[model samples]
Target: MGSNPAAPIEVHDLTVAYRKKPVLWDIDFELPEGRLIGLVGPNGAGKSTLIKAIMGLMPLLSGYVRVYGQPLEDRRELVGYVPQRESVDWDFPVDALDVVTMGRYGRMGLFTRPSKEDYEIAMACLDKVGMADYAKRQISQLSGGQQQRVFLARALTQDASIYLMDEPFAGVDAATEKAIIELLKELKSKQKTVLVVHHDLNTAEEYFDWLMLLNMRLVKFGETRDVFTQENLRMTYGGKLHLLSEAAEKVARQ
Candidate 1:
């Protein structure tokens, strides 16, 4: 199939498996550019897995992902990723500014080190996320909300056209959540696409303009008001797929 230039993200026949068990199956969807999208699903519903596959971090069992009508590898510079906070080793002895500087590494190349201007850019991004004062503080010393802000700062430094974030609001305080929502709005205003893996059903409608509901498959994907209905929520969260749930549980245990 031909790629859609207008869509910032497109997944065709995407499937991911672990040890012969499928996590996401036959996933297909295209996200419009410049919108805040929420990937909402239950635990083990392959939210993180889908983002990983799109980023080319995980081996796809089958199918393809395209960003701006190009393969992910070809479009790496155009995409920024904010991984789950738990995925990182916070105690690794890196300060907040150092962590944000890592975002510029992609643009800096393998041999060149971050220059003084790069540090300025990183600090500017930290200030955007309201974490400039703690730039020199160790990442481990920051609270959960503070750590999340730092990660966002790093993504901002990438200056990408599309951003994929995993559970950004999880464990954050109300103020942090509000700040993130505002940042997302700013990105949208600038015509950037953002796909966030979100867990809270209560605020999903309020936070995102679009929604992609997944349950080991594509249940629905569209505008929030149209797809974020009672019936869709039941299909996503309600216990309708016992076998899939069992497989997901097994994979989680591994």
Candidate 2:
């Protein structure tokens, strides 16, 4: 275990299951602060499950998760999460600004409305993501990339020390992908820790300083240079040849 009490995230003996079928088993890792980390694995390998368990959004079958050396409940305000785009209900009645303002709910009391400062902050975040012009647009009316940007702005409004995002780049134009990565780098410059669920093996090392290769277990977790080896990729993907070749070429190019 890390001796640093302020490690961004720590999980010990963590396990989670669905319908009595284990998805994550005895997962354990302690993350350092101020880095962009990527969680990569094959589909159904429990990548999203791990993030949910860490956020306390799922019932853990056993073990525990700690954030900044405290239980998630005590550190809720310090963490922010952006769920997968597929998991969100874009049809719900809300405008872009309204969605971003919801991020401030954590700082509010029950039944309290957002104050002026909260709206200001939300607008600022929206502007940061280049969605300020669409503040009044309905969420469902926006393009996929625009919707994703709105969600990222919402996470930014929380101003959290740690942010966990699930597949933020799953589907988007190249410009949007580039913009999101740039925003993530900005967060890193502020010494914020970010863990992203990434699907593209070819870009994993290019995007993150640390890589966590998971396949229903903690296959490998460490600096990207050390953990992005061929053996680790094979273990994580069960010898998927094409992906391996692509990743190898990416590494060679770098």
Best by lDDT: 2
Task: Give each model's whole-structure lDDT.
Answer: 0.90, 0.91
Candidate 2 pairs with clashing backbones: none
lDDT tens digits, residues 53-113, model 2?
Answer: 9999999999988898899999998998898888879999989999999999999999899
TM-score of each: 0.92, 0.94
**Once model 2 is optimally superposed onto the true structure by TM-score, how far is the C-alpha of residue 68 displaced, in angstroms?**
0.9
Q: After superposition, how far is residue 117 of candidate 1 from its true place, in Å?
A: 1.0
Over all chains combined, what TM-score does candidate 1 have?
Answer: 0.92
What's the lDDT for residue 190 in model 2? 99
What tens-digit string does per-residue lDDT give for candidate 1 at 161-237? Answer: 99999999988987788889889999999999999999777678889999999989989999999998877877887
Question: Least accurate stretch of 10 residues (summed lDDT) in model 2?
Answer: 245-254
RMSD of each: 4.9, 2.7
